[model samples]
Structure formats: C-alpha cells, structure tokens
Target: MDLMFLRATLLFILGVYANSLAVAKFIATSGRHKVKVICFSKTGERAAPFIRQAAKDYFSEASFAYVLWREIDMAFWWNMFGVDSAPSVVFLKDIYSKPITYSGSFNHLQLVKMMDDYKKNDIPQLRLVSSMELGCDARGYSRSGNETVTWYCLILVGRAGHAMTQMRETLRRASDVLMVGDDSDYARNVNLSVAIVASAAMKENRLTFTWLDGEVQQKYCQFHLAPEYHTKSCGPSYEDGVDAPQILIVRYLRNLTDDNAKNDRWKHFRNQYLGDTKVASQLIARYPGPEDVEELIQWISHIVERGDTREFPYFTFETPDLVPEDKQSMGSPVGQSFSRGINNRLKKLHMYISDLPRDPRVGPSLLLAACLLFGTIWLQNNRTKQANNTPGDLASSTSSRGRARARPARTDDVPPSMTDEEPKDAYQWVTTDSDSE
Candidate 1:
C-alpha cells in the first residue's frame, strides 16, 4: 500500500515538472525580443497588471512575460543564464545568449526613458571597419575575400583629434540620410536597400560607412595612398610633412562561388581623395552647413552608379581647409575649485556615515543598544556582589552565636588530684539532687 501510494505521488510530481518545463520553453520562444519582469509573489500580483499595461504602452514592439521571484530557480538561472535578481527586467533579444538585466523598481516615466534608447539595440551603426578581419592587407580599404556581401564603404582616415571628431559627426549625419528613405517614391527607391534591411528582413547593408585611425595605422595608410600624398609628405604644407586627415571610398566586390566569364570578376575599386579639401568640396558645394550631409549622400549615390574610376584613382580638389577651431581655454581655476569642493563634500559624507553610530538611521537604535549594554553590565555586577556576600553573611551569623553551656547537676563525684594524672578511659559520675532521694 505504501509503495503504491509513493508511485502515484512520484507520477504526479513528474507531471508537474514536465508541465513547468513546457511553460518555460513556450515563454522563451514566444518573441524576437522578450521582456521578462520578475518580482516577489506578493509584489508580482500588484505589479503584474501595471507591468503588462506599461510594457504594452512603452514597449509595444516587444513581447512581454512575467515570472514570480520564487519560481525563478536562481541556482539554475545563475549557472545557465546568469540571472540572479528579483524586481528586475531582463531583455532576451536572442534566446541563445544571456539576457541584459535591468534591476530595481521603475515607474512608467523611468521605464520609458530607459527603454527608448534600448529599442534600437539591434540596429547596426557605422562602426570601425577592421582591416585584419577583412584581409584587406591595407588601410583605407576593406576587400576581405571572406565577405559574403559587397560593401561600398566611405572611410575617413585621420589622427584622433578635433578634426576626426567633426568627421565622426558628419558620418552620423550622412548615415541618418543614407540609412532611411524620405516620403517620396524616388527617394524610397534610392534608399530601398537600407530601408529593406532596416526592418531586419535583410542581413547586410549594400553600402556601409566606417573610419580608420591614421596615427596607429600609419604604415598601412601610407601604402594605400599615392606616394606623393603619403602621411610623411602631405600636411599643412610640403615642408612640415605632418599627418593630416583624408577621406576615401572603397568598393569591395563579392566573392564568386563558381568562376564564370565576366568582365573582371574579382576587381576591387578605390578612390583615395587627398586632404579635407577634395572630400569637403565634393560634400559641400559652398559653405559647410547642415545640408552638406544631404549633398554628400547624393554624391555617394552617383559614385556607386559611375563604377570604378580607372583614369585617376586619386583626386585633389582645392577648397578651404575644414579644420575646426578650439576656442575654449584649456583649464579654469574656478571650475577646478568647484570640482575639488564637490569631491571634498563626497569624502566628508562618506566619512560621516562610515560608522554605525554616525549614520542618521542608526541613531535611535544605537542609543537603545548602548543603554541595554550598560544595563546588562550593571545587573551582572550587582548579582556577583550579592553572591560574594551570601557565604560571608552566613558564616558571621554562625560565629555570633556562642557554644551552648550544659546545666550543672548536684552530684557525688570523685575528683582527680592535681599531682596525679587521670586515667584516659576513667569517667566521673555526678548525682542529681532529684536522684539523691
């Protein structure tokens, strides 16, 4: 009977375990981007409605799920998925990797603010192109044979300073135009490749943008450019030979699986323009303004259609030098003193709260604790003193009472002589007056 009951119980537990696994798997696989809100059992019930509602309102694009804090098997999650917090939100973009965790309580406003920037977490930015990964063997070019897609890369090569800073901003401005389509039908077609991929339907960009650090990549940069316009030769002037920023466009051709008869199947295109002048001239017709980025996009589109320029790979156009001026003074004493004051205040605050007695929250409790401690010590001391006096008092009471005296009786007695010693065993007999009769 015992064994039969045990078997039935085991079967029920197994069913429950299997059901839980199924539920967890279903939740994991339900969405491209999953937001799992975790809270304690009591808090979970209260937060559940708000979480669901806010998730819909703020993160309408993502699928949301909820898990009780107790149900989150922290030991398993810590080892398998690296999750170890409650009252937290985890974003699981791809199910294979550990999710990004955002901990603590968040209201609607805070939640929206935190999540707005993260919605585009999957979008690709114009990152730095790696020459080593691409096997370009040269800077200012990305011609990796391993690439599955062709890339028309706009590369800015320069020392990392104020000038490169402007270039980075320009790339961002240009990307805004090139990565999305305007409302017009013609504009949409022009940016069709980018738009199609923006929705995540496509995996690669038809045209990409990136930059290279010239200071570190000087050797490779020199080899890629014409000998006359090398880093050592071209700068502010011919005499100085200082390194200056240059912009170049490289076209990498896709690798063919099977060779077929075609015009230069493996040909790579490059247009290395010297100085900021030629690049800026093509980008900005007159003075550099906000619209220059738009003009630059048009020029890039035209170049993509024009094919490789065989006549002159290198072009130099004379335009005003586009170096940005730094107007602010290097340092300010007032700013330094303000910073120092803030630091000193932080240090003082840290020191003040470093001990239990000093913290404002601990004041009342600490006083109570001190009083209890002294009270206990006083009680113990009194107890010890009383215990020590107890035995002494009892001994004095016994000593105060003299030895009891035996009452004398009238007796016929034999007295021992002074000169004679009494026998050790001899006893004297006394007769009482009452016994005399």
Candidate 2:
C-alpha cells in the first residue's frame, strides 16, 4: 500500500509540473516585455530587502539572487567580476559577449534594467560602399567621393588638458594618431596626408591671415575662382584654381581661456547685425552655442524654427580633450599648465570624412557617438566604466536581461509538492456528525 501511495504521489507531481508548463506557455504567448521573476530570500543579506522593495514598487519584472552564500560568491566575484564592496548588484544577459552592469556600492539590478532600456541598446552597421557612422545618431558613413580634393592642409590645436583618463582613452580610440605638439612644416607645406595641432593659446588666425604680401587668403573652388575673402587653404593658390577634396579638422587645447580677450570684436559685430532680431532680444528664442547656430541672428533669421546645427552630425557634438601628465611646454603660464594633457575628440561629421574604417563590432567610436546622440554623457561614462570593469562578466549580464523579458510567466500552476498523501495518524481528513454525537 505504501509503495502504491508513493507511485500515486509521483504521478500527481508530474501532472502539476505539466500544468505549470502549459500556463507558462500561455503567458509567454500573451505578454511581450512584461514578464519578470523575483528571486530572493527573506532572511538574508541586504540583497533580499532591496529585491523585495524593487518588486513591490512595480518593478513587475524585478528580482533577487538570494545570495545563497555571500562570502563564497562574494569572494568568487571579487576574484571574478571584481565585486569590491557592498551595494553591488549585476544585470546579466544571455548573450556571450556583452556588458554586465553594476549600479554602485549600492548598485541594484533593477536599476540597470530600467536605465539600459532594451530599445536603446544598438551597434553601428557599416554601409560597405559608403561611410559607417557608429557614434552619433545624426552620423553615418557618408562620402560623396565625387567632389575634387578642393582643399587640404594639416590643421591644429589638440587636446592639451582634460578632466578624466577614460576621456584620454576615448580620444585615442577616436583617431589614428594623437597630435602631441606643433607640426609647423606640415602646416606650411601641403599634400602630406596630414599631421597638425591646434594651439588655441596662440591662434595665428591663419584662417584670417592674408598672404605675406597683402592679398586676402582665398581658394579657387571649382567654377568660382578669383575669390574674395579669407577661407582655408591646402594645395594650389587661386592662380592655379584647381578644385580638390577638402578636409577640415578642429583640434582644441586641453584647457580653455578667453580666445577672444578684451577686444571682443565678435560681440560688437553681433550687436550691430543681430540687434533687432527676435533671437538676440527674446528669451523665447534662446541662443545656441558658438559651435552651432550663431548666438542670435540665425535664430531669428529663419522663418521655420527647429533645432540648431549642434543637433546635426556635421556640426556640434564635440567632447573635451586630454592634457598629458608630463610635458616640456612653450607658451603663456596658462598654456604651459595645459601642455601635458592631450585628449582628442573629433566632431562626428569630420570622422565620416576621414578615411577611417567602419566596423559595427567596434566599441569606442560608436559608443562615443551614441553618447553624443542620446546626449547622455554620464550614462555613457557609466557604460564605459562597466565596460572597463569585468569585461566578460558585464556582457553576460546584459544578455540575461534581454532574455528575462523574453521569457513568459506561469501564474496559474499549483504549488510544488501537492501530490503527497495525508498522514492517517497525524491528522484527520474530515469531520463526521455521527462521530461527534
């Protein structure tokens, strides 16, 4: 009889498990990105409390790891994922190569899921024949390749100082070389592929410079030569008037001071030309930064209003430069101080123009571009930090989250262990009126 009872219990357990699987199927087929599991233990480390709260707060898909053995696992992670201190939760993924994110000393998994919204995760894809723009949403690999090399010259002013080291890394990954210092001969001569740095501390306004004789600097752009006004130059003088492809790069010194000291001619120019425009006068029409639309005019000048050039790819999204830690510098006291640091960031549009390869598989370039597009420097920095830390671990973490939301929930199954028979001696199954009498 006991053997028979055991068999019956096993059958019941199997039935229950089958029902649970069916219910799970229904839920998966029904909701998308709605399923979540709460994995936690009640009497455990701080991990449990956070999971409970996260789940209670409508983190409907939230969960816990229960931290079965804090020390064993902690030790493993410290050696494994570099889990140094408390408040550490990781968001893992099913994919093999991805990022595992940590919220902080007090990091939580729930926070990572919310912050790294599934939709926002993307990598750049190369167009093959065209340019591959990985960095900015507005950027894509675009090269007409049709235009003549209209102009060419080594440009200047590179990152002479910066705020962070990762910033330095980001800069290096962005370019082919770091513009350490002056490339005077390259600047003076033309057609050497190129190497130059911008020394904002001592800008020569070579852009505004007239020939050594007295004629204004001009280019003989195709169909329109004998030009009149100062512009950039590369190969032939206007006398030759040959049109060729032109490349322009703006490098910056690490530290910044008044580029236009006390004289302030730009201010005067703006006051005269833009004074009456609504942009200059009204708060409703605020000013765009110098890199994009002018401080005022372009704002009021246009009939149709929208975003400024800064929002575009070829225009404004530029990051800060890095100053080297050591240097034997030249220039003013301010310039000398910034001499060491050199973090270089190029405008996305220019990168598209430069002959750099396009690989969606790469990280820094697109990551930097994505940061610019989403306009989330902090979040990007965090991603980069997580990236640098526990490289393999982080990637796994993201894959887990992606898979989590994909799994369906089974909300209607009977509890686990429902097949056991009742104990005859220990408990009564029912009450009888006759027995009571």
Candidate 3:
C-alpha cells in the first residue's frame, strides 16, 4: 500500500510539471491572455485586491489577474519580453510574443485604462489613395501618387472596422517583424520602400497602398469578388451578408500605347486574395491566422520584393498546395546563385595563373635577366674587396724585402786566415820576448 501511494505521488508531480511546460510554450507563442501583472510576496498581497477590482471594473472578460512573482519565472519574462524588474505590468496583443512592459509600481485604474486604450487603438482607418499622399509616415518621408501607378499597388477594398481593422493592424505589425527596428540608412530607405507596398508609399515609385469603400465602389467590388464567390454581384445588396473586405494588387506599364502594351503591362493588374493560405505560406513558411497581422505583412513584402516589372510586373504567390509543380525549398535562391557566381570567377582566376608559365618568350627572358643581375652584383663585390687590400699588401711586401737586404753577409764562408799554417811560429815569438827582457 505504501509503495503504491509513493508511485502515485511521483506520477502526479511529473504530470503537473509537464502541463506547466506546455502552458508556458503556448503563452509564449499565442497572445491569448491580456494582462500578466507580477508582484512579489508582501507587495503582491497588498496590490492583489486592487488589481482584481480594476480587472472586474473595466476588462473583466479580457484581463489576466495579478500573479505572485514567485509563481512566475522571471527569466522567461526577461528573455521573451525584456522584462527584468519586478512588480511589472505586461500588456499583450499576442501573449506569446513581446508585450508592452511597464516597470515598477503603478496605479490599478491607470493600468486598466492603458490596456483598454491599446485595444481600441489597433483599428486602422482607410487613408485616401492618391499620387499626392504617402501611407505609413511614422518615420517621415512623403510619397507622391503618380509614381505608384507605374508599379505594383496593393489596395484593401472594404468598409472600415471589423475585418478591415484586423487586416490593417496585421499589415502594420508585419512591418515591425520585417524591419526589426533597423535604424541604418540603407535598411531604412530600401526596406521602407518595399515594405510600404502594403502599408504606405511615396509618389516616387515601386510599390504602394490604398483602400476602397465596399458600398461606394460596388462595381469595382463585384468585379473582384465575383470570381472568388462565383456570384453575379457583391456588396450590401448581395444575397447573403458575407460582406467581407478584399485585397487586390495592380501593375501598370510605362510609355507604351501600342497593342502589345496591354498584353505586356496591364495583364498583371488582376486581384490576388490576401486571405489565401497559399499566399500566406509564401511569406512566412506557415499559414497565418486571421489576426496574425505581422505574418500577413511579411507575405506582402515577400511578393513585392520578387516582383519584376519587365517580365511579369506582379507576384504569382503560388505555393505547394496550389501548384505542386512550381513548389521549391524554403531556402533563398540568392545565396546559392551568389556562391555559384563566385565559384566561376575563382576557376577563371586559376586558369589565368596556370597559363602564365606557358608563355615561352616571357619565361626565358625572365630567367636570362635574373642571371645577368646576379653576375653584375658578384663582379662589383670582388672589385671592392681587391681595392681595399691593395695598399696593405704592398706595405707588407716592401718591409720583408728590406729586412732581408739589411742582414750582414756570413763571414763563416771566408777562409780562416790560412788555417793550414802550423802553430811553430807562436813558440818562437815567446822566446824573443824573454831575451829582450
């Protein structure tokens, strides 16, 4: 019985731990919960009642109540949301992603109001499409209208609010993901131009954005909607209240009024549905939910970047599901193409070096020149050494010759005073001296 109880306890703990991990992952990826206020011990206990009251008062349906700091992992928040300080308020659009963080203590009412305002502010009103106006001027750079007519244009046609608002918010957030807060000059200028195809534009060129009213432009709506719904018309007067907005892109040509001009340029002005799963897959490699604005904008940017005016002037946005024959791996072709070009250049360089020694005249001339240079240097060094030794050699030779001549001739070679004479004369001389004395 004891063993069984112990086993059950351990199993229960393991299950709880596994469930917690799964929940954490979901919270990190999906922004389901609205508010996650963290406070520690005494401070959290004191603020709990007020935090609950605030949620109850304003955001009862949407808000998450205060959580004890000990119960929540600080490192997770730090890594995910860049939140390090305690007693912080996290306002989320997508709880699984980065949230708007408020560090330190704050009033409950103010917190509630801030969250409420953030939700309300997400709706995007239609900005007038003109050659004179620019979309998304948050960073500043005005665009003209005439410039967009010649390039691809993404226009959201619908009534303001509801689905339109969600789409617009998604488009805006997509820029944040693609741009990633780049402040460099090139990124700012180039990416801004490409990204604004679905968000903003200048009258200068390339891509642009605009919207149309569903009720006001019924004919235009019906023309785009009929093919998708297989209906004769669309708008408020339609048989069903399926009054959803639609997205379309237009491509225009330049300086040609000939018959082939229509075939070349105007053929790509056809509408492409933004809600298509295949289209979304082209942008982020996964299907984005309706509220996934960031994913949607990235998709638009992908198509705009690949668009070529000379060839097609628009993007096919074809994915594997729609056209399996055209499907390709997710890796970019740019890197592979660049590597192949570099390899070709290196091979040419190797061939050029290998052929250098094959030039008959050049090889012989260089070798002969090198030999002559070495001979000249050797002759010069020999001459310098001989010149330096000339005086010392002469002096040494002169002293040696003088010492030989100064020595006396050998007297040993002279006859020894006729030594052949006998010694009898010496005895006779001694006797004469004695007689004289």
Candidate 4:
C-alpha cells in the first residue's frame, strides 16, 4: 500500500511539471500577446479619441497608443516607416516587428476603410530576402552584392508613379506577405511591414483627360509607359508628338517628382550615373559581340525573375530573385549579362551612352571606391601574411600553436639529445669554423 501511494505521488508531480514546462515554452516562442500600435499626430487633439478606439476595438490583442511628435523621429521613425509623415498610424505586433505605416488623417469612414486594408496582412512568410539586420537602408549603393546583404525584408523594384501601382499590384498578389513602403507605419496599426520606394520622375506627365468641366487633373492614371519604346521626339502627351511615337522616358521621369524634390535628385542620379555614356562604352569593350544586347536581356530576365527569394534581401527595393537566366550564376555568361544591363540601356543607339555618368557623385564612383577599399584590405592581408613568413617565423608560430595543449614530457620520456649535452665533436666535419649551409 505504501509503495503504491509513493508511486502515484511521483507520477502526479511529473505530470504537473511537464504541463508547467509546456506552458512556459509556448509563451517564450509565440511573441507578444497584444498588438502595440503607434498613431502619430502633429495636429494633436483632432486624432485623439479615434486613435484610442482603433487600438481598443480592432487590435484588442495589441497595446495601441498614440505618439504625438512635433519633430518626427527620423532615426527611429523612418526605420519604422519606409519614410515618415504626420497624422499617421502604424499597425503591427510591436515596433520590433517593423509594422506597416499608412500616412495622413482621415474621417471616421476613411479611417475604417484604411484599417480594413491594414488588417489584410499579406506576405505571410517574412522572408529574409537579404541577410541584413533590422535598420540598414537596403536601397542605395551600400547594398551591392559584395557588401554581405543586410536587413532587407523585402525589396521592391521600379521607382514611384505608375511603377508604384504595378508594385502595389504585385504585393497584393502575393497573398502571404506584406512589404515596406515608408520609414514608419502609416498609422498605429502594427500588422503591416515598413519600407519605402524612392520617387524619381515621369517625363513631365503623360496622362491627359478632360473631366469635371474644364481640365481636371487625372494623375490617377496607371499605365504611363507604352509597352515598348521607339526613337523620336515624342513629347509628354500624345498630342505633342505625331511622327515620332516613342515611349518618352523623359515623361516617365517627370512623373517621379513630389513635394520632397526627390524627382529632381533622382533624375540627377539617373542622368549623371545611371545613364552615363562612358559606362556603356566600358561594357562594349568587355562584351563586344553582335548579339550582346539580346543575350544580356535574357540574362537579366532570368536573374530578376528568380530574385533573391532564395536568400534574405539586402535592401527594401532590391529583390534577391535570380537575375536573368544568362546571369543566373556569377559564371561568365551571367556576369556579362550584368555588364550588359549596366552598359546596354542605349546599346541600340549609335551614340554609346553609359548608364553611369562621368560626374563623381554617381553611385559607380562610390562602388569603385568600395571595390578599391576592399582591394586595399586584401593587399593588407597579403602583406601581413608575407611579413609573418619572415624566413622562419611562420613555421615556428604555427607549430607552437599546434603544440599548445600537448601533454608534458615525463622524465622517462625525455630524449637523450635534450637531456644531455652534444658530444664535442658531433658532426664536426671538415674542421671548418664556419660550416657550409
């Protein structure tokens, strides 16, 4: 009877311990219980009560709150949103999640519509796409292939305007994922992701329609670029050009501007750096062939299509998907394909234009500097290695390290040579004071 009672007690205790451990583990791995949203306002009171109710009613699992900032926290804010603006709400599990942000104030109905959209979290698997950590800017030159891709959750392609619509459509299609569009959450919602795509230009407005009586602006038009390009002085609107009907990249560029003057800077970068004549020349030098453009385009198509989806992303807009097929691996064909992408944008033209300009501020210069810096580091490493091999030091240091944990020699194991002095005439050949080496 006593033995049975003891056994039963032990069994009960074991079950209780196992249950407690399981509960503890569940809490540790599952993450935050309540969503923590941050609503931002420069206008203050106009957004107070609505902010509170949004958090309480919708994100009951989230700890929703408002953060009024006269001076936006660029350091933390942009990282939270792809870019930051006022009267915004961010929704997500926590700031650590880098939740999504939607900008601007809205009426009760507008707010509800926006919230309904925010709750629709897509991109279920927040792929690394890049190996970078949380806050690095995946967009600029720093995110070249060699830099060990940093914290890029997603990387969008194409600049703003119609491209934005295309990209947004793509995101919507990817059911299980959410992407970043700005530095902070648009509002305090916390379920979306944080990111932003820089705006450049659209050749000065391509869409025109007469609406609302006398000339209403239809910036809302989507397909700005024709499917292909032709060579001519095709102006912004169809009425501007009749003979030379071409896809004016100029108009596409003009469409990229915004209140921030980003379109101008982007154009400056594109013309001086991205569309340089010299870069194209260098490419021709490298991959001079009759069918180079065709080959190059195929290569890029393959790589871009696969994207960096296999690995973590390095930047917000730069997907790690495979490059064009020819540029699939960094093998010769793929490498040449990349060269073509850089230099061959205007390959069909007689005037060989480089994607990068001669100006110094261009990204190529920065890229070159980085390459040189890395080369210098490699040279430094080689120099250090050569210096260490100063006749006999290399072998000695390596051997010494190898022997660090070796067992000590016992008295009985001592060799006769080490234990006793050498004979006076050992190997005293030829009677020379200075022996021939």
- Against the reference, the lDDT scores of all candidates come to 0.47, 0.30, 0.46, 0.36
Give the winner by TM-score: 3 or 4: 3
Number of backbone-clashing residue pairs for each candidate, in the order shown: 1, 49, 13, 105
lDDT sort, best first? 1, 3, 4, 2
In candidate 4, which residue ranges exceed 4 Å CA deviation?
Answer: 1-31, 43-47, 95-98, 123-437
Look at candidate 1 and tell me the lDDT of residue 331: 35
What are the models' TM-scores? 0.29, 0.18, 0.28, 0.22
By TM-score, the best candidate is: 1
Candidate 3 similarity to native, TM-score? 0.28
After superposing candidate 1 on the true structure, give the runs of residues whose Cα lies further than 4 Å from its correct spot.
1-150, 183-204, 232-243, 254-258, 261-291, 308-437
TM-score of 2: 0.18
How well is each residue in 276-301 modelled by candidate 2, as lDDT tens digits? 21111101121222322121112222
Which pairs of residues clash in candidate 1, taking residues 3 or more apart in a chain or in different chains? 411-431
Superior candidate under TM-score, 1 versus 2: 1
lDDT of 4 by residue, 1-437 (tens): 99999997787666556644643453344333333455677755554676557655663234455555544244345643543777776666422344577777766677677666764543221111111221111222112232222112222222222333333333343212212222334312332221111100001111110101000111111122232221111123344433221111100011112212333655444543454322110000011122222232232223322332333222111223222211122356456546555543443232213423533457777899999999999999999888966957778887887898585756886567753787766784575466554
Models sorted by TM-score, best on top: 1, 3, 4, 2
